[model samples]
Target: YQNDIGQREAERGHLARELHDNALHQLLMLKRSVEEPTAALEFPAAYELLVADLRQIISDLRPATLNYGLRPALDGLVDALSGRDENGPAISLDVSGAGESYGPEVDLHAYRIVQQACENALEHAHPRILTIRGRLEPDLIELTVEDDGQGFDVDAQLDLAKLVAHKHFGLAGLYERAAIIGAELQIDSAPGRGTGVRLTWHSRDK
Candidate 1:
């Protein structure tokens, strides 16, 4: 399952790279071309917004940072989001258990799970503070994304997550990803205590 997911991710990354280098560049050039001094009031602005959305989709489809090791990839994730809005949820990244490295598949899935969790926090939770924690233990690797935001009803959301694509939730996808890697997932949230998503897989699972 890990191998299959890895291959799919690789293909998505390749396609993302191509779109970014070819199609996205063309869009940029077109935007520049339409930026005439007397162009319509909304054309340039709308096109510019479209270009930005394309870039974000490319990034989300497959994170380029995962090409590096997991720690740096995690760093890249934080770096990409940290400066996007000065007033947006402040973020911090902490990595512990020095000199321990999981295999590539573990890193890949874990990275993605954390990334999605953060996106959920930012988009749904409306968090004021976001944090990612990575801890590599002798027997297990744990990754956590926690937030300070308006929490939700975990029971209802988890039920809805199980129904994704129809009545689904974003965390539903994360649950499947965790399953593929043999990781146990825990979601803790309430009305005001914020949300925390934790994924832990045994080292032997690698």
Candidate 2:
């Protein structure tokens, strides 16, 4: 599943690049065409709007924030994911105790883990607050995504691997992801309380 996810992200990046290049080229051409005062295209404003929307889509598909580093990228992602609901899921992020960089691969996986966790919470939790915290210790790193929302019975959800065998790909995928990185994944939740997703990885992991 990790391989599949990586491949999909590669494909997505490729597609986004192609789309962005073509759209940008066309947008520039249109601007030049309109710049020729003789070319009487009254829809230049519409073209500009379309270009802005297309640029936004491209950014959404392939974020350049990753180039700045993991934590910055995650900060941008949180801003993008948080909704404008006055009373819904006011998201927050915290990063602490940085030692050596975790390397690009670990950062990639870490970002995906947090991204998916926030998405799942937004879709199902209907929460009042969602927080994603990262703690980089001397020998290990831990990520925690917590939400105050409608919680569930963890044991009921597990049912001794039965739930894992079937539906709930979001969570099962998270489990597989943590294992792939030699990380420990934990869930703390109870009905009417809230849910917390935690991923911990020691520096010894490959």
Pairs in steric clash, model 1: 164-168
Q: What TM-score does candidate 2 reach?
A: 0.68
- Candidate 2 lDDT tens digits, 17-42: 86677666666667766777665474
The sequence of per-residue lDDT tens digits that candidate 1 reaches over residues 43-155 is 66657766776776766665666666567778889998898898898899987864244666777788888887998899888888899987867667788899999998888
Could you estimate the TM-score for every candidate?
0.70, 0.68
Window of ten residues with lowest summed lDDT in model 1: 160-169
> Candidate 1: TM-score?
0.70
RMSD of 1: 6.5
Q: Give each model's whole-structure lDDT.
A: 0.75, 0.72
Best by TM-score: 1
* Cα lDDT for residue 72, candidate 2: 75
What local lDDT score does residue 52 receive in model 1, on the 0 to 100 scale?
71
